[model samples]
Target: MTQQNPGSAPDEESPAGDPWHAFGYLVAGVAMYGFLGWLADRWLGTSFLVVLGILLGAGLGLYMTFARFNRPPDPQSKQEKN
Candidate 1:
């Protein structure tokens, strides 16, 4: 019998395969939304919009991360079980 390499990279469908990609998504969401909020604050002369924007961004990022990482396995992948 042949042994598989423990150090081999995981496939794209595995969450462990690309942690940085998920992190990038979260950071990008926060930065983009926060920047938008900052612009709105400057335009409206309000200090709260920036805070709101950051919160909204964080919530969205968390939701996206959870959704992407905690999904049901694909039906096609189940065929490999046999």
Candidate 2:
């Protein structure tokens, strides 16, 4: 049997994968929505849309992060591996 490296992990279970993905989702969501909100605020001459946009972005980001990283493993794939 081949041995795994002590410091190595499979891609699925890799420690370096999830945090960066989550952070990217969050930052991208916030940046995108925040920009939209700022634009809306500017157009409407209002100040609250930016905050609302940021909140919405953050919520969506969290949702995406959870959805992506919290998935259940596929039984078919497991069986195939075995």
Candidate 3:
């Protein structure tokens, strides 16, 4: 007697979900790392740490984004739905 809405699956990704989420992650990572690097440069009187931090942040962000978004969905979840 229970009816499920055809469009109500929780596993479905909205059309704008992944890309926007990835973009937000990348921007936040870059800004946070860059700010930390800038602080380090100010404290240590060095000129290179800001650039390094930005690069490291970008690399890490990209790695995280791809790792999270590019993987296939879990097989167990699919089976459980049925």
By descending TM-score, how would the candidates be arranged? 2, 3, 1
After TM-score superposition, what is the CA distance of residue 80 in candidate 3 from its true location, in Å? 4.0
Model 1 Cα RMSD, Å? 5.1
* Consecutive 10-residue window with the lowest summed lDDT within model 3: 9-18
Best by lDDT: 2
Q: Write the per-residue lDDT of candidate 2 for residues 1-82, one digit (tens) a residue.
A: 7555566453444343458889999999999999999999999999999999999999999999989877787686465445
Least accurate 10 contiguous residues by lDDT in model 1: 8-17
lDDT-better candidate, 1 vs 3 = 3
Candidate 3 has an lDDT of: 0.81
Model 1 residue runs over 4 Å out of place are 1-17
lDDT score of model 1? 0.77
Write one digit per residue (lDDT tens) for candidate 1, span 1-82. Answer: 5453476443434443367767887888889889999999999999898888888888888888788778788886555434
The lDDT, on a scale of 0 to 1, for candidate 2 is: 0.84
TM agreement with the true structure for every prediction: 0.74, 0.77, 0.74
How does each model score on lDDT? 0.77, 0.84, 0.81
TM-score of 2: 0.77
